[model samples]
Target: MPTIVHEFDWPDRIVVGTVGQPGARTFYLQVRGGRRVVSAALEKEQSAILAEKIDEILDELMAGEGNPFSIQATTPVELVDNEPLEMPVDEQFRTGAIGLGWDPATAQVVIEAYPLVVVDEADIELSEDGDGVEAIVVEPEEMLLVRMPVGTARAFAKRTREIVGAGRPLCPRCGDPMDPEGHDCVFPEA
Candidate 1:
């Protein structure tokens, strides 16, 4: 019989940690001393986040040791869904999670839109079919921004909105995406 594994439980001894990436829709986590497992308890929207967190954790573990660890011990150390595949982020999102603010002392990014915010933003070129990224624009959260085609801008905006509605992959506040490992938001008090 074909084995269908929906989700697995973590062991009692496994420890859990989190990893956040910039502009990523889901929060990646690091689970220590556990079996190789996938989850499906989360909704379609959550599939991306869980997969991202798991991949990140596993990658780190593999990179550090140069070998895949055996997933031993099975029980829930932390909450995780084993189903639902996360949506892939476009190339333009490289700096999508950067906040809106300009640092006078630092450089800035170029935005295609006018009156750009001070936060970091990326410029993506859309193709006629409008699926894969044609090109990318990276700039600081200040000064000169890039220019985009009308159609491309519209598509980019729509994607950005989707990420935000998904609970933001980076800091809870500021709405900036974090690195694959995550970033500490330094937003100042008002």
Candidate 2:
């Protein structure tokens, strides 16, 4: 089957937002271009790492000797989006893998999210000669792709970090997330 690609080049709005309470929040990477919107469910760690990597890429570009592309070191004020995820919040797919890259030509950050792949015994195929097992390869049925300029990228990272940090507080002693009801801390022996 051919893969369905929800591509948004130079998206007008792209962000990582959550639904539900902090402890049980569901993180979503949503992008909008015109009236078209795509939302992909992702883990909190994935969102945090994506933001960290994007900042690293932008910072590196900014620190270049001449700074040719003029990457912004901070999120542009005008591009800051604090609004909640778009209405309906229809989830197209749950992200299995995320790919990030920089397009030097356009000075844009490219993000690609692939749907989780589930392999069943039926998916496995036998070798031509049926002598040995064939290698297994899994492909997603759909993916979300977005490209954002430097300023927008910076803003995206900033908002994503904030959203990730807003989750449950960490236990001061054990460094584990604290549940609203309570927390059991296990201290290490000296």
TM-score of each: 0.19, 0.92
lDDT tens digits, residue span 1-190, model 1:
3322222122211111112332433322111124442211222233344234334433344465434343222222233233222323112112123112211222211131122224334444334446665654433332212222222222323333343345435556676665656577788446
User: Compared with the true structure, what per-residue lDDT tens digits does model 2 show for residues 41-82?
Assistant: 999999999999999999988999999999878888999999
Stretches of model 1 off by over 4 angstroms after superposition:
1-144, 168-190
Where is model 2 poorest over a 10-residue stretch in terms of lDDT?
Answer: 125-134
Candidate with top lDDT is 2
User: How accurate locally is residue 3 in candidate 2, as Cα lDDT from 0 to 100?
Assistant: 84
Best by TM-score: 2
Error of 2 at 6 (Å): 0.2
